[model samples]
Target chain A: MHAIKTLSLSILLGCFSLPALAEDPADADPWEGFNRAVFSFNDTLDRYALKPAAKSYKAITPDIIETGVSNFFGNLSDVGSMLNNVLQLKGGAAGQDFGRIMFNSTVGLGGIIDVATPMGLPEHNEDFGQTLGYWGMETGPYLVLPLLGPSNIRDGLGLIPDSMVDPVAEVDPIRTRNQLYGLRIIDTRAGLLAAEELLTGDRYTAMRDAYLQRREFLVNDGKVASFDQDQF
Target chain B: MKKSIIALAVAGALTAPMVAQADATLYGSLRIKAQKLEGTSHDNLNVTDNSSRIGIKGSSELFNGATAFFQFEQAVSTDTGAWNGGRLGNLGVKGDFGTAIFGRIWTPYYSFTGAPTDILDNATSASSTYVINAHRASDVIAYVSPDMGGLTLAAAVLPTDKGAADDETLDIKHVAANYAMGGFTAGVSYLGFPAADVDVMSAALSYTAGDFYVATRYENRDAGVNGPTEEDAYEVAGSYTMGNTTLLANFINDDDNVDDVISVEVQQKLGKQARAFAAIIDSNVADGGDGFEVGYRVDF
Candidate 1:
């Protein structure tokens, strides 16, 4: 568990700091103000909110995994695409579907292909944090979310990339790169399987805050000081 | 009159061999475009893309870790409730062995070699080419193998659903292949029509050599109506991302023996859900050339 947290932290830091390795602080990113404001708003969420909500994420890890697998299989429409190009495999009775099944077995399930999984194959693990960091974004303010948890501007930007890699995100890289595509559906589902129980408060507010703070942490890589929600 | 519907029902029958589980899902893309037309002043370009569709897909866990599944797809036009043709239907089953789709779906033929959307503001009407036209033919089935060390194989057959015809009898058949790994990807496909016997072959290659994405496609169809009748299309497109804006540019060439055409497009996005796009196309046929056209599209 400690290793997981540490690794997550390292990845968060690496993704946000890449592009600005040498740039001067003077350059404003145009949307920096909106970024700052949203960043501040999200951070407040943690102080007045999320740490308690995280208990739910912690409890439902298994369900998150399940839905994650489903999502992975749902997107791999092109698994059999390549072979059809070289051979004129007609569509009817001679239907070809193994490409899809195998993809679902591996990528969808988070690389636990059972058979395919043994080949040292691993899941194409993508999350909101890694997404923002990959895009050369910077982790801005340190914020304690209302119902979510710690976050910042960099994390907010990270949401775009995270959603980009999200199994549900319509765009891809995450779409095609999912190795154990099918398993991811299950893994993500399994991860959140328990959340269904604790979802009482303003479930909407809780979810909104949790999602925002998570995105914030992903972008900032947990680098800055916590935001004071009282200011907002 | 209702051959298309019969063909559609027959497709559902094909997948019956495999037992369906609760996993089966229905999904598809729906697009409605309004544009301006060229030569024939039809006023606005009330165009519906062959791209619009809906499908049901799902899988069941079989014994010994194997899984069985199937998918059925249909062309759904917002402009018109009726299907475009046989090219729109597809159904098939998949197991640990591989995936097979029958009825009417993307032929491995069109999967790799279909024409680009850039040729026309809309495929149903303004299409400068018919190489990937799925509406003209029907009753096709295809199969794809499981991934082999990241490589997979696929093929399809477009059977002649009709008994026989007097003047025009459409009998279509085809095959195709694709390989993608890392940043470099390449694909090729071919389609054959037995009656008029028009054969269309298409190939696409896209490589993400870094931050920029470069893609190109070349397709040609022998219309057969006229000796050496040509229905060809080509596209050269590339995109680059800077901050929130992803800039895209594309150039296309469409030739159908009847009309020789060229088009260009540029697009930008504000974020994930919104975009601004503009394109211009010029067609020069065997007869006279229809100057130029400018167009745009947005997604909700």
Candidate 2:
């Protein structure tokens, strides 16, 4: 019994003394303090303002109308996606995006319905950020934009060029354009309501890490270092 | 018409950029198994659901680096097409200090001790002696300390509502400590049923080296004022992975019950979120029998 006790003590001590895994990369978030403050501000605004508004919008809208609104915005975004795919030299993806725009706009009643997907013309979410990443630009420091949430130096810069070609931004008459932007924002947030349950751990950290990992996944077209789908 | 419209809406949401939002995450696993059992009078082939479940979890920053979180999980019966089994529902807060959750929860005793050797996706848990303790329970309040070096401590209490039993407010209590470093982990746990004056002690050790993993557990239950005096159980399990394929084996013995179980399995990974597996199990009890099973699991 004494010898058994001694063995157990030794094993316990060994377990405690074993080395730990390496720490997270320090350079990933050089501006963590500022970024955290911005994240908090954005989170507060989302909780108090945007989320409630989106919830109300979803509550009032019919499912068909909601889907139509989302599809319309999606159809418009395909134009920019096609441009970005061409810029990144992905001919197949560019063609598919072009096909989606034409099919959805014509047969689908000005994009109010999405006939392209059922017709095997899948949506490709190409953007200027992904184009830059495909051309070998490194994602710099993580940043949390006010009200916009997680981003990085490269993607943030890419967003400027992306906005220039945004169909909503190009809409004539300031009032109509602003209304379209507001509707799009509410629809997007409402669409995310069902997905919110996937978040885990620290809200800020989970969002940041997911954003970074997803960006890498997109830029490499799903060729990620690790693909553990069981992780939540 | 409504269903088609809803389906389209779902498709649109699924194609959206998934990682930009700060909200709860929804995830699930679906597993179904086909099996054949032998050495039993009514031995037959059966298709069964294997603990498939879906869950939603979220956390919100509270104050001073602390955050509040909640999770709700429910089992889905794939074979029967039913979805009414509740697995977990808990709310908690955590920070540098620790985590405290109250609701239905997996017992610390099971997590620290039984989990090491409860590796088989199915059949093994029911055939093994680790069924001595309740794996999960409602009305549980659990606490887990933040990691100190490689050591972590956890505790839980199950309280009975007034007038529910013989006035024992504290129905069951559990305490556990675990140490994890690199690829090695060790744990010890103690559980007590105050009303019955029964107690259990268990220990587990596990190691992972690259593609190989092994674990062992020992448990002793003192069934005071209950039955069978004392029961002791032990189990050992091991697994090896090569590329997308993994092989696993486990053996369990209950000294008091004179029961023994042996199980082996081979699993093949399909992409990132899906797997197919085949298993064989044999147990030496009156109704216990040999069985073969094939299953598929996918998670999202």
Candidate 3:
């Protein structure tokens, strides 16, 4: 309950900074101060509580079970991605994601196994944030949310609408839903454990820039954008 | 479509037997360049096939937790449409005990000294002219230790027979060790021809982060014969990738009458499998030699 209150408070604070993000500067980060504070809070929480839990999860879970859990979550994400592809009007990608979902859900035994990839139905990663960007939304100031983590204005807004389309969000039995959500978070964090060794420089800024760059790349779909003439 | 079908048929026929035995992969690269060389005496222009090669490599699991692998690579002259001589041929067995291989292979010394800094497509890289023992040797046997915490040691020997009346002698010996950690690598290599009275030693270090990669190499050579000729060479190279283009540059100083060379190259990626590149090489020797080349390369 306390964690939920903190999460809601962070969202409220993040929303208050959106206006400043709109009117402020041309740089990628306009809410550096507030974002830094949130980043510190998130980092402290990760270092103390979340990291330990993820470590324990990794140590206790067998490899095959962990892989099955990851595959199940991945199938769930693909379902959301197919909807996002429709919203973005990417017909070809939507067809591919649709094919993936069909094959994986059936042959893969409720997404516990991944037999589709070897059959050459490659994964397509689409999200509501990418959909917003495809519709000509400029990624606003980099913001760090409390429990949700790094995001921008458009992507943060995207979460609200996108969550409604997610089947997991509609699950009955509040305890089960909460447990699933918690497991997802823990699984994701545990997956990133090996990557922590590569961190260098200022952790907060490095992570922020990497996140923003990756988001930009995904939004552009591996294409370089021409320079905006007005910037000259 | 007809030509592609014939080509595919030919390739399939050639690889059919290998495929049945192991996981054979038919891979090749086609690199053709239009080159111009300028010297103090004359200028020249020619189209050259820059180490274009096709190879088949495969590996299969052996009994007792070991794996057996073999590779046969042959150079092809794209300009003349002719198959050149073999580039590499070797068979090996690898397991936790490490790898043991025999036949034509690159000496560990060549890989340790040259691999890090030679980023260009063709002859422009200073290593071609500056480094003496950069070429591969035939009749070779090599052993490589399994990686121990990112550190690996390798040793190779090239044995040659002088004539029918004489026994085989190990003419060349090479030993190298490399350590790699998080996009950073450091290596040292030594090459010795005891019968020929020549020795070469080199050390190299490289680091890669984000869009930039940089490397430096230092080498010393002692040709004990011919009035005790001794020389040293130093090279520094770097490359930066920005979007679809990668810019590369290298400088080498061979300590023989202050001879030096500098090369710059730019490669633009056409797609996933093809790239077009241009390079210029300038040498500061007294004779004044330089070259310019434009090339396109495709890998399959």
Candidate 4:
């Protein structure tokens, strides 16, 4: 029954991703399942906590690590190209340009900064699970993968190729590895970082739900799913 | 050639029924952490490391040998309780002859030493310590060579899209070769960045045993086209895996001449997805005793 529930959810989520299913996205945006619950919690935090605290703390507030992390991923544009080979995506025309730019910026500069596009190569979007989907693998079940957050069986397995090509994960020194991950959470818990003191609601539930919905939006390329439509 | 490439992608897409493979699986890890380190050199004092995020990558094949691939990853942090990370978002694409992408991409000159650290694994003083990070360059593009045996070459170019005569005119390029047979693996890479025209060569060798993989590497560099010359670099590391448990340990040396460094790190993976890590780092030079760091991390 649990597996059935997960599968049902996966199908519901999966169906909404098709370019065809988005015809009536107004009623399906921010689909329910795990995402709906997360949206609700994030809304609650914004209403009762984060918004109120922002006015006062904004002045002295430190920025979140997400910026760094996003930069980290943004910096290594070639990772997508490597994965594209394994997944077989539609990027040949641009892959060379993209790969050239990423390789030049990252490795050439000791990864201190990206020198990819400013040079010449164009950017490309690619990954494994998408390759699997393009290859015919079923999405399996919609699962909130414990701490790693949102995922379906298909994407879960997709990690294999991503990890395989990830230059950071491939780095050896504990220093470089740790440094890459060094600023991971401070920014993640930005709202919670300072406001851990002002909570009137269940923080865990609030965080967990918010996390799940965020993943859903991310995984679906910002497209709104069916169940998410009912929410305001 | 491009036609055949698209044909292949389209063929791959055709094999997979649209309904069964509709939405690509979305996966990524969000790491929320804090790190403080004391170091010499550079103006930033008692710098606080900021590294955290959540990203998504997916792809679908077209009937003409083309595959639709993309990724959306942003800094996931608590600023205003919304998706906020100065790094912005990124996307990618790949097919036939090569691949292409957009969004923030890594600069090549900086990517040479992809992994040359000891015990720092993002927990200690070493997390944000590298000298090459320039944040994410926008409107970026890149490419790679199809593997011929263990040899695959790649390169990237960055144009100062800002439309300025004196805008950033730096060019970075790199090529890497890797080989794997049974449990033994080895790799060598080269980098040439002309903005500073620093030519560098990095090599790595390793082997795996019963959940444990050990590696050693060395880097020889000519610091810049005309800047002060720096030191050589070297390191050794090992990762042990048993079931869901993997342990990592390493010792590293970055003899940058100006401010040399020696460090160590030990980390235990609770599972493939999460790890608890710790490290100690120190840098000594003409100035004086430099720095140190210690911490733990959990990724989701």
Interface RMSD of each: 17.3, 17.6, 16.7, 15.1
Candidate 4 yields a Cα-based lDDT of: 0.48
Each candidate's number of clashing pairs is 123, 10, 0, 140
Tell me how candidate 3 scores on lDDT.
0.73
- Residue B167, model 2: lDDT of 71
Model 3 DockQ (Cα-based): 0.01
Off by over 4 Å in 1: A1-232, B1-21, B43-51, B80-88, B115-129, B132-137, B149-151, B161-170, B194-198, B223-232, B242-245, B257-260, B266-276, B284-300
The alpha-carbon deviation from the true structure for residue B201 of candidate 4, after best TM-score superposition, in angstroms, is 3.0
Query: Candidate 4: which stretches are off by over 4 Å?
Result: A1-232, B1-28, B32-50, B77-90, B96-98, B106-113, B116-120, B123-129, B134-139, B160-170, B195-197, B225-227, B243-245, B257-264, B282-300
* Predicted candidate 2 versus true structure: per-residue lDDT over B1-300, tens digit per residue: 699999999999999876654379999999988776775652776778988999999988886879999889999999877895899999999998899989987777777777877766757753443355367778899999999999999999888421226677688788999999999899998887787777888899999998789999988878662255787778899887655556678988876444687887766566699876667778765653687666778999
Judging by lDDT against the true structure, name the best candidate. Answer: 2
Q: DockQ of each model against the real complex?
A: 0.01, 0.01, 0.01, 0.01
| Candidates sorted on lDDT, descending | 2, 3, 4, 1
- Across residues A1-84, which tens digit of lDDT does each residue of candidate 3 receive? 112222322332332222322233338787889988998998899899988998999999998988998888778878878898
lDDT for each residue of candidate 1 in A1-232, tens digit (9 for 90 to 100) = 1112212233334323332222332232334445455546754553344434444544655745544544444334223222222133222101112222233333334222332222222223234444445465555543333323234455544444433333333536675545443333333333343443444454333333343444445344444446545544
Model 3 residue runs over 4 Å out of place are A1-232, B1-19, B40-42, B126-134, B161-168, B224-228, B256-258, B284-288
TM-score of chain B of 3: 0.85
Model 2 residue B253 lDDT score: 85
